[model samples]
Target: MSAAWSAGCVRARSMLSRRVGAGGARELASRASLEEVLQQLAAGPYQRGIRPGQSLEDAQRAVAATVLWHLRVLAGWLPREGAESVRALAGWFEVANVVEQVQQPGTPPYLLGSLAVSWPRLARAASPEQMREELAASPWGDPGGSDPRTIAVGVQFAWAVRVAERVPRAQDWAAGGAALLFARERFLAEQPLAEPAVRRAAVLLGADAVGSASFADLRARLRGDARWVLSDVDGPGELWRAEVRWWDRVARDALKLLRTTGFGPDVVVGCAVLLGVDARKVRAALEISARGGRPLEAFDVLA
Candidate 1:
């Protein structure tokens, strides 16, 4: 392999290992290599193209071809029963046409609740065809199979926090899990989607950070308490609106309740119940930071 291709593979492996679990790492890495091959073919000779910068659309399409190839190749690794696994990864990738078709830009805010339901099953698809069939079976239709290449850019565009939420707890080095949790928030904020539930995932993920959200998701979460109705959030490079009426309600009058807090331990564990993030990851991270370093933390890291 050329040095450039080799380096790209290395970068792909490192990121995939972080994004997916160790179980899927090698396969994901190999798929990334194959993706580079596909991209070179589709974009013309890779060596010649690199000397001169390509147009934005060309660069975008090339990167997209890489993401689709990886998605298809990685999904191929699953067992017949691994549909759920494949589906989750696909959800992590958040194919764009699905996002665009389902959501509108100006709607109520929302959270990850409804969106999270699809992820586990989405990750389970055994092949690209299977992935396409699965999404088609849902309300989203078959965005992948109909025009796989055309939509891959949209897929990369849509991934965001939906991907970060999938990171297994064992991957985080910090005991507090703060870094990974923080990372998830940042990813969503960085690529905040128009979808409310997805937007809420980022909002619930971080407090001081920025991200966009439709009012629908925000209102859905605000079924109760409130000192405030809406707040400005930071997204990719700008500020967007989010509502926190309920959060303010709990923080102000309902503050004394031990179980009421959303940002602390019990809440984190409860979030684990809802979000499927391993509590050990969060606890381990907290402990590591608190103690500076220890054996249990290492064991948790290994977990």
Candidate 2:
């Protein structure tokens, strides 16, 4: 690795060290109201994101923006290869922003820092079809069709392939893409696979694995880190738990690699990914708390 890459990794590792843990998120979840959650956030890394008298929606948007800001700074410091991997990972944010714009046109923007340049065009999209066309010309590519849901999934699949190519051992993205395809086949759509993502995943996971009735056969077809997605997952109701577990395993493995390897882009990329997952967990917990639900008996901690 170059000296710049080494220095970037060191800086990123330092930043990752300050990320909130699962216990802190659970504490926020235990709060009786959104006000209390904001109070807790008032004194932490998320404090800057919490505006005075901020509603739950506003706070959530701020938190999302904060996570993107961290990623932006990390990407700016890394070498070309490292920056490429980080940008590839950040592409997921752009996909999500597209979905949000399609679903809620007038909503405030909470996009990735790297994608600020495109926000103007996306914000002006009069309809979902127009937004889809705009994304087609971008790195995210066409979502196979004009439908919003399909576009989201297609963008995700494209991102998975891109990340897998740019980052070594980044199998989690492919696994996630496969999981979504299987979920759609088994529970949501219950039809033959037609989307490009499903076909690509099928090449490695088998053409019949997605629609198969037997979970064992389906799991057996997955390779590398993708197989873990099916562990202990019985049906659609249990899929969320399975995903949380899978991400936990992926994040831990990334952290382990960061620990064992010498200075390189992997460390920077891994730190960004782990931090992003941590932010996801925090957001999930906050949503439950905002709903006035009880403390996380049904939720799996994502540290």
Candidate 3:
């Protein structure tokens, strides 16, 4: 391995070591109050993002911010191509920023800093049309049209494609995510598939799958690794489990990647995914704690 790859892999593993493991997260959930949860987090890697007495939404965003910061640090340790791959994975933040910009322009955007694909330019967009134009000019490509919903969905599909193209190992992850997106629109939200979404789905999952008439049909249309994400999902109410299963699958695959790969981008990517999974588990645990639910209650959604 090159010196940069070696250093980056080392940094990745070090960052992974700092995660609050599944057991630790469950323990946090078992705490008596959010106060106790916050106290526990203050002594860990989350201390930088979390604070005393923050609302659940704010606290979750803080956790996400901290994870993004970690990704930025990891990216700094890598060479050009590896850093670009990290940046591709990090595009989800940029996608969130854009969606928030369209849905609630007054909301303050997440500070993406060096990991941004086009937030610097997109932030200045005064209208959805301007945002669409800015995205077309940037790495995100055209958002189909200026409709806020279309723009939101377009950017997400674009992010998935970017990840698949830039980090080949993440192809299954990207496909699985896109399949879930389709399921959400069709089953959970019960909204008709818009033209832009249909086009994107056709491109991502193929023509036959895009024409799925129901959730069962959609799940049946998926092949190979992408099909497994929806294997246990039966209906809209069960969609949450599909998301939970997605996280579980990601953690499992990422761990395997970490074990099999040496000093390379795969190691860095695996580490990044694991960090994301840990952060998500922590956030879920905090949610359960805030609700005064038992720790075991969290395992249903978290396990």
Candidate 4:
């Protein structure tokens, strides 16, 4: 590895030690209340963003914000190429900003600083047409059209494509996620895939498979790693489990990458993915705690 990547990899691995692992998240889930959860997290890496009295939505956003901040710090240690890869993964934050901008104008953005893709330009957009124009001019590219719902789906697909292009190892994960996005729209939401969405899915899943009428049809049509994401998902009610399984798959794949790869972009990406898994686990735990449910029940799908 180059000296810069070597240094960045070292930093990435070191950051992994800061995560509240599965065990810690389970413990947090066992807490009696959100206050207890926050009190326990007060001394951790997430302490800055998560605080007492924040609503569940605010706390979830805080978890994401904390993860983004780590990505920003990690990017600073990387070379230009390595930093670009991290930046591509960080596009989720930009997508979130765009979604919020389309859904609710003037809500404060996630504060991405230098890691931003198009938030600076997107923030200034006063209407959907302006938003589409700005996105077309930026790296995110048009998001297909200005319709808020279509734009949301389009940006997500764009983010997946960008990540797959920059981080080749993440191609399967990106495609799997895109597959799930289509599945959710088709099954859980009971909505037909929008024309733009179908067109985007065709890029990764092929035109023949994108029009599958049922989960079984879609699963049979898929011939790549993306198919496994829906392995045992029978219907809409179990879709939540499919999502949980997706994260489980991500966590497993990331761990394997960390264990098998030397100090390189794969290791950096692996570290980032693992951190994301931990953040999601923590968020789930907080939700359970806030609802006064059994602590371990928060992860029932994993069982």
Best by lDDT: 3
Candidate 4 residues lying further than 4 Å off, grouped into runs, are 293-295
lDDT tens per residue, model 3, 153-246: 8888888778878899998888888888888877888866657567766666767887888888888888565777788788767888888778
Q: Tens digits of per-residue lDDT for model 4 on 158-206?
A: 8887887888888888888888888887877876655656776777776
Which one wins by lDDT: 2 or 4? 4
- How many Å off is the CA of 259 in candidate 2? 1.0
- Sorting all predicted structures by TM-score, with the top scorer first, yields 4, 3, 2, 1
Tens digit per residue, CA lDDT, model 1, 55-144: 333433333334434434433433332223334434533454333333422222212232243544544554555555666565334444
Off by over 4 Å in 2: 115-124, 189-194, 203-217, 301-303
Can you give the TM-score per candidate against the true fold?
0.27, 0.86, 0.93, 0.93
lDDT string for model 2 (1-303, tens) is 788888788888887765677777777777777777877777777776876578877887777777788888887888778777777777667766777777766776665666343555666767878877876676656666766667666666666766676676676655665665566555656544446757655644556665457555566656645666776676666666776676777788778767867888668767887787778767766776787747577445433
Pairs of residues at least 3 apart in sequence or in different chains that clash in candidate 3: none
Instruction: Show where candidate 1 strays beyond 4 Å.
Output: 1-54, 80-83, 92-95, 98-199, 202-303
Ranking by lDDT: 3, 4, 2, 1
> Which candidate, 2 or 3, has the higher TM-score?
3
The C-alpha local distance difference test score for the whole of candidate 3 amounts to: 0.84
Prediction 3 TM-score vs. true: 0.93
On the 0 to 100 scale, the lDDT of residue 17 in model 2 is 65
User: What TM-score should be assigned to candidate 2?
Assistant: 0.86
